[model samples]
Target: MEKILVVDDDLGIQKQLKWSFAGYEVIFAEDRASAIAQLRRFEPKVVTLDLGLPPDPANATEGMATLEEILELAPQTKVIVVTGNNDKKNALRAINLGAYDFYQKPIDSDTIQILVSRAMNLFNLEMENRHLAAVAPSMDKIIGQSESILAASRKAERIAQTDISTLLLGESGTGKEVFARSIHEHSLRKDKAFVAINCASIPENLLESELFGYEKGAFTGANKTTPGKIETAQNGTLFLDEIGDMPIGLQAKMLRFLQERVIERVGGRSEIPVDIRVICATHRDIPGMVAEQTFREDLYYRIGEISILIPPLRERNNDVVLLARTFLAQYNEEFKTKIKGFSEGAIKAMSQHKWPGNIRELQNKLKSAVIMAEGTHIQAEDLNLTFNNDALSIDTLNLREVREHAESRAIRNAYQIAERNMSRTAELLGVTRPTLYSLIDKYHMDDIKTG
Candidate 1:
């Protein structure tokens, strides 16, 4: 049930509209103060507002004030104005003030309904798109040129052309979500909504309603009928982040929706058709989860039609310097600093560090360095990546050998610090469990095993 606030002084018009819009939850406000109070309380997505109010019934002043107030309170709300036929100038002004649309009053139910329905649909669509974009990875802010990142970019471009579900698999802070949005922008459905939801962020009980939506009275707090993320993403892309955290029960429903391209509201009987392309990302071993029966096999197959593995920053040669320079320029402008670039020693330290937290960690370090560095050049000390005299003397000869030694040492340290907890060890090392398992395989470290 979409909630609509009808603000008009005419009692007869209000009564007729209230009864007619049986499909909606209608709230009425007869005066400016009452209407504003209702607006603050209800926060309706679509409002039918009369430009003539009690204090200034013959003029548009009071109505315009209400319109401005509504906009300030909820910038996203769609307020449709109702004005007299002769008040064309005022109606135009209302539109400029951000009214969704206007209806010249001699109130006809059919016409009003048409206008209201359109406004409601558009409002829902916009809201859904915003949600999608929020969840999907956006690449607009990411700056990089490493071979690994470039390869991932190429893959993302190709994946965007098809409507196939893509799974971005990587460790945390590797910019998996950024690739997801690049896919959206490059895809054919670029104009449509790009909806994103994080399985890990939302609570289990509310997750289903957030994804599948609910009809009025579907749940304790559900006061109106609403389209879920899936419905909103119709003809668009839906990005699900940290998908490994989705509950087992909801996984089944999501799998069903993926298979059938339809969903039923949590408490609704009707199946709503949806036309959405799904993209999922996680720092978990989904295949392992499927084998363990923690995640449904069917959903795994559906979401991973194509899987793209994002290489960690440490693995992407030369990308560290490239990204650091980019971030340096960005934060310099952001922080209003005169820092030119990194010192040669700072660059060396950045290249040599393991980058356990990957790109995100590097970004934070650079941001801090830019803010704290007093001189034009950022030094290794400013970046907090100190080079111990003994560690620095280790021969730079045999680069691959050096990397293997670093990887082994980091794994061993992480395991010992985590008390042999594989999950905690993997997290400390800034690698996904699967990646950690691979390391365990490579290094033959069975002694460090922990469930």
Candidate 2:
């Protein structure tokens, strides 16, 4: 059961509070000294503090001191200060001093109880949100930790604090949307909407109206006045996905909106202002398109203030294995299966396969495999990878080859994950720095970039 600490000097009020709250386990203290003692002992999530303690029942001095001390002792506790009917000044002062809320009293059971309940609810909600923020992954929760992906992630994060117009350049299925959201999540506009519109998905005829609003009776289908995606994302983020595919005629209007933070409706003359951070993304070669005169050079310059290029799956060595395992675990829980992990042959096949569709393709394959897997462990055949036994069996049978292969891969993955901080990589590989350098030299991987 939840606990509430009531700190009031009046005996009658104490008894009234004890009887009023039936669901909560109410504890009482009559002075600041006793109240603080009960607070540390019980560590109650909520507190009702009356600013009418001994030596200052006529004034708010003693009670305000207590409130300040209570907050200093436990910053997380929600302390609600009760004051006299006309004591608005002291109530506001208590709030400034970090008290959760203030309530003026002739303490009715219904009204005071409701306020207390609301405070309790808010306290719980804030705690939960804090917990989620603590465990939430960086890079917009994208899973791979390879050097190429990490390099892009570092650049994205470094630029996330400002309101720069960010352009994400990557091949299809390389998680451009995920990185775009990382920028939003790390910015000043995190609390507001992260609105996204696919310029390629919507038809050219409808795309303009979708981005900018139209008045009532503007057209045959426009029976009611409608707000566009740009207006709806006020004081937030507007993600323009597949911007390379936007119509050439509409590019001039978009450029105007970026230059001046205002937009005109499809059939209206008045320019409505909007406050938003614009982030664009595309899988197409936008620069090449500009050279070809298919895409506007002016619009390209407007959105490309900070461009981050995400590497495709094949170039990110060992990331395919990492991403596959993450997808396997996710699907196992969703499908309610007990599939342990991938077999050696399955891992080899996935590592060598060209992931043309990238992360999206890998996820779909794993989702299908989890559903089709009949045994506790998924095999090579489950993912439709041909296990060339005659060719690969000799290598798998050699203990020295297996150990050396695993050791080399482990060292490489650790080095990348640590972003090539030599000390960190050494610690992760459970070796001295000199030992790690020796292994690197022995493996003939000195040409690989460590930065």
Report the backbone clash tally of model 2.
0
lDDT (tens digit, per residue) of candidate 2 on 1-451? 8999999989898999988788999999988999999999999889999998887789888899999889999998998898876676787688777777666666667546655776788688668756755764445466565788888988887888788998999899998998988889988899999999999999999999999989888889998889999999999999999999999999999999999999998888899999999999999999899999989999999999989999999899878987887788788789887676665556767877788988888887788888987654566667776544223344367654465467667886898899888889999999766556545533434333432
Q: Give the per-residue Cα lDDT of candidate 1 at 385.
A: 90
RMSD of each: 27.6, 22.0
The whole-model C-alpha lDDT of candidate 2 against the native structure comes to 0.82
lDDT of each model, Cα atoms only? Answer: 0.81, 0.82
Per-residue error at 32 for model 1, in Å? 68
Each candidate's clash count: 6, 0
Worst 10 residues of 2 by lDDT: 442-451
Compose the digit string of candidate 1's lDDT tens values, residues 159-253.
77798889999999998877888888878899999999999999999999999999999878888998888889889999999999999989989
Superposition TM-score, candidate 1 onto the true structure: 0.55
Models 1 onward score TM values of 0.55, 0.58
| Model 2 misplacement above 4 A | 1-137, 387-451
